[model samples]
Target: MSSLSTRFWIEAAREEIQDWENECSYCKRAKSKSAIQIMAPLPDIRLDMPMRAFAHTAVDYAGPYITIQGCGKRREKRYLCLFTCLTSRAVHLEMAYGLDTSSFLNAFYRFTSRRGVTVKMNSDNGTNFVGIKGTFEETRY
Candidate 1:
């Protein structure tokens, strides 16, 4: 269909993609006729832990959902900080006002006050998370 509509043939497009070596790796993978062999999921010992709720926690931030800031016509984007327990599969949600360390700390405070201290936490290298890591380390020391 694309070959009929566009000026170039499908083979030409494939050849063009092959010319860009970086893109061809992905294109070649997509064009392969063989059935995909997916690896089985790896097992984690932490998930099998006999522990209390919110013990082994994983923290991540979601979206910048638009919300009304104050009383009037002012609106602001907010991010949702999600805390989940690996062992119990329990979840806790907190609304963060900003992506800064202070805002993240406020949400962290709210989470800890409600759920208590967590044994382990896993999260991606978001700047907010990285900033607070030093604070947590200092407190521990």
Candidate 2:
């Protein structure tokens, strides 16, 4: 249909044919022919844990959004420090003033003080986290 339509005098025939081909079911099935299927789902280990909150935790840094300063017409960048319990799936959020180690430590301290010391913590290889981890290691030693 595309080649036949292009042979005629229809305006934008190639673009219309391309659009129709994109939404066509035959094109979709052709595209999925080489796809692979997943064999099985991974094991769920969250059910075997004792009734403890934040025993295993995953921590991540979120965003840097603008916030109003106190009693003044000023906007400052703030980030979210997220702490998630692996077993209970509970989340704790803390505001970070900046992406520095001090701010992250303050948030972490607040979380630990409230939720108790976590047994395990998982985080990505962000630079601020790397610094914080190094500082904690030094203090432990």
lDDT of 1 by residue, 1-141 (tens): 466547745656655655775566776776778889998874473546855788778889999899986785888899999998887678899999999999999998899999888877888879999988779987972
Best by lDDT: 2
Candidate 1, after superposition: displacement of residue 96 in Å? 0.2
Q: Each candidate's root-mean-square deviation in Å?
A: 10.5, 7.3
Tell me the lDDT of model 2 at 67: 91
lDDT score for candidate 1 against the true structure: 0.82
Candidate 1, superposed: residue stretches over 4 Å from native: 1-45, 48-50, 70-72
RMSD (CA, Å), candidate 2 to true, equals 7.3
Give per-model TM-scores.
0.65, 0.64
lDDT at 60, model 2: 91
Show how many residue pairs clash in every candidate, following the order shown.
Answer: 0, 0
Global fold similarity of model 1 (TM-score)? 0.65
Across 1-141, the per-residue lDDT of candidate 2 in tens digits comes to 656866778878778878987899998777676758986753354444856899888889989889989886999999999999888789999999899989999999899899998777778878888888767777651
Worst 10 residues of 1 by lDDT: 42-51
Which residue ranges in model 2 land beyond 4 Å of their true spot? 1-48
